[model samples]
Target: MSKTLVLMRHGKSSWKDNLPDDERLLKKRAYKDIEHVASAFKHCLDKDFVFKSSYAERAESTAKHFLKQLGIPETHLHIESDLYTFDESSLKAFLYTVDDSLDNLMLFGHNPAFTNLANALGDQYFDNLPTSGLVMMHFKNSSWKDLASGKTILHLFPKNLR
Candidate 1:
């Protein structure tokens, strides 16, 4: 069975509050970016998809905004603390834990990990996955544990969309 994975980097965060890294809130521009991407991405969503996000405030907020823009209920979002890391290996390990029964998984989290994962699993090479960026890849494998190089079907970034 083929699998689809959509990786989204959290929106641009605000540093004005001098808050902890995980507590930083999103910038006003982030909302606009999320709205732009979500509107264009709605049609591409799988009928049955799981949307998960990191526990960080920015990531959680980004996921919520996407669901709101797409009209998906908040109950559909899952908060996974393990996704808060910046390491790609940790992200891959978390992916391996996802049940094989699901064909599509969408994740919203921090960068470096997301960018690294995309470069590793996708056919395309991206210098960086900008804030509010989303990439969709289709894997020909049946399980998340076996996920490998996949065809990068869509790559959306705020700057490009504007």
Candidate 2:
């Protein structure tokens, strides 16, 4: 079975200390970027995608916006706190727990880690996953456990769409 993975970085967050890290919401521009990327994904919604997002407000808000715009049911969405700042190994462990029934999966998380994880599973080198950037990758196998670098088919970012 073929598998598609959509990896997105969280939108820009308010840096004010008044709000906790987890409570920081997306900035206005970030929301705009999210909408742009979500609109792009709408063309591919027929792929039957499942979404997994970090529990942080920015990430969750980004995921919610995508769900709302893409008309994806909330039941197919998961909020995982573990994905907040995890490394490739941690992301691999999380992917291991995903149900095999899901064919196309989207992950909304933070940068550096998300960028690294995407690079680790696909032969793409992104200096940084900019705010609200989205990357789509295709793997030959059905299972996430078997994913590795050099298997990517496509990659895109919000700025690219601009």
lDDT for each of the candidates?
0.95, 0.81
- Candidate 2: tens digits of C-alpha lDDT, residues 29-99: 88778888888767777787878899999999988887887777777888887888748778878877777
Candidate 1 global Cα RMSD = 0.7
Q: Write the per-residue lDDT of candidate 1 for residues 1-162, one digit (tens) a residue.
A: 999999999999999979999999999999999999998898886468899999999999999999999889999999999999999999999999999999999999988999999999999999999999999999999999999889999999999888
Once fitted onto the true fold, the runs of candidate 2 whose alpha carbons sit more than 4 angstroms away are none
Candidate 1 CA-lDDT value: 0.95
Cα displacement (Å) at residue 139, model 1: 0.3
Candidate 2 lDDT for residue 112: 78
Backbone collision tally, model 2: 1
TM-score between model 1 and native: 0.98
| Candidate 1: residue 100 lDDT (0-100) | 96
Give the Å error, residue 129, model 2: 0.9
